[model samples]
Target: MSRKFKKVVEYTFLILLACIFIFPLIWMVASSMKPEANIPVDMGSIQSLLPSIVPSEWFQTYQELFSRFDVFQYIFNSVTYAIVVTLGSIVVNAMAGYAFSKFDFIGKKVLFGLLIALLIVPAETLIITQFTVAHDLGILNTRLAVILPMIANMFFIYLFRNFFKAIPDEIIESVKLDGANYWTIFWKIILPMSKPAIATVGTLSFILSWNDYLWPLMVLTDSEKFPLQVAITNINTTPPVYTNQVMAILTISTIPLIIVYIVAQKYLLQGLGGSGTGIK
Candidate 1:
């Protein structure tokens, strides 16, 4: 085949793959705009997937949603929790990664190995223990309870460690010769250079924390404290089954995370690719 024909084929294949990933999101946005009376009855029809732009049913749905529930409060709670968790995870996980990469200490290998092993363990298995610890500390039903357990994730630590390990030893040694302590090096040199890794971890951490339903549901009893994800669930299970309102809320809940990923996607991809290579 000619080179031009091969390029056309490759582009076609890529577009198809992109469509496969994108169609569901499109469907979701479409569904969110539908009226309760128009849903289920109209589902799977082309009309169901095509949102009415002139009247904009989605806006009406959102208006009803906000009127009924404090949706803004849920959004605020989600943003606050996600940001705190992301920032705290960056500090804690990055520090642990840096220590594992640069420091020589007792049981270092064993500790890192344990951390690696933890990556294979199911997070669901730890819920009871995490709840117990939170209860013991008198933090249950508080924002801290929701935030604390998620701060030190193993995958992020591994990402930072591998990324840090890839930095030249000569650079660290030069900084050390310049009377720099580990903190100085970390704050001034390491973190700034690790932006891609930071972005990767931050984006993932934000998404996980933002979308977390079960933990927040378990810990936060007050409706006022409910994050968007849990709040949306409450909407779903409530009486009369306002499917349109549920869809609208879900659509709103997803927008911020999508915006975040779009903004940081470049760094996220670079960080993951770099970490994968570094680990080998």
Candidate 2:
């Protein structure tokens, strides 16, 4: 086979694969724009991938969702929760990473080893224990119950630690020699240099907090406090479940995540690349 022909074949295969992956998103957006009755009728056809031509129908599903559901409140709660958790995770995890990478405290090695071991444990396994602890602490049904448990992800801490390990000791020593304290060096020097890691962690943290349904659902009973993910599920149980509205909610819920990924794409790639090299 000619090299040019092989390249074409590979490109064709990849395009088809990309289409297969993207079809669902296309169908969703398309379906969300359609009327409830038209959705099922259009399924399994090319029309399923295209939005309704009627301009009024374009936003009718979303209009009904907003008017009927307290979607804005749910979005606000989710955004608030996500932001708080993301910031807290970055600060706490990065500090832990920096300490592990540069400090010489006792039991550090053992603690770090345990932390690394935690990476293998599935988060689902700890949900019951986490719920028990939250109940004991009287934080259940509050934002703290959701935010506190999610803020300390072991994988993120591991990522930050490995990324910090790649930094040269000489730079830290030089900063110290210039009369900078550990906090000063960490906040000013280390953090600024770790933009890629920060972007990666922050983006992932936001997504995690935003998409978290099971934990929030288990802990929170108040309808008003429920996040977008939890509240959206209520539509299924509520009478007159509209498929178009459900698709609309999902489509809307996905926007923030897509925006985050797009904005952090460059740093995410760089961070992942740097992390691979930094792992010792």
Count clashing residue pairs per candidate: 0, 0
> What is the Cα-based TM-score of model 2?
0.87
lDDT of 1 by residue, 1-280 (tens): 6999999999999999997998777777776776777777767777777665547565787898899999999999999999999999999999999999999999998998888898888778788998888889999899998999889988888889999999998999999999999999999999999988888898878877887878999999999999998998899998866877887888999899779878987766654532333322
Per-residue lDDT of candidate 2, residues 176-271 (tens digit): 999999999999889999988898888878877888889999999999899988888897678899888998988888899899878777766644
lDDT of 1 at 224: 96
Global CA lDDT computed for model 1:
0.85
In candidate 2, the residue pairs with backbone N, CA or C atoms under 3 Å apart (3 or more residues apart, or in different chains) clash, namely: none
Task: Report the number of the highest-TM-score candidate.
Answer: 2
lDDT of 2: 0.87
lDDT of each: 0.85, 0.87
Error of 2 at 109 (Å): 1.8
- In TM-score terms, candidate 1 sits at 0.84
Candidate 2 deviant stretches above 4 angstroms: 1-17, 269-280
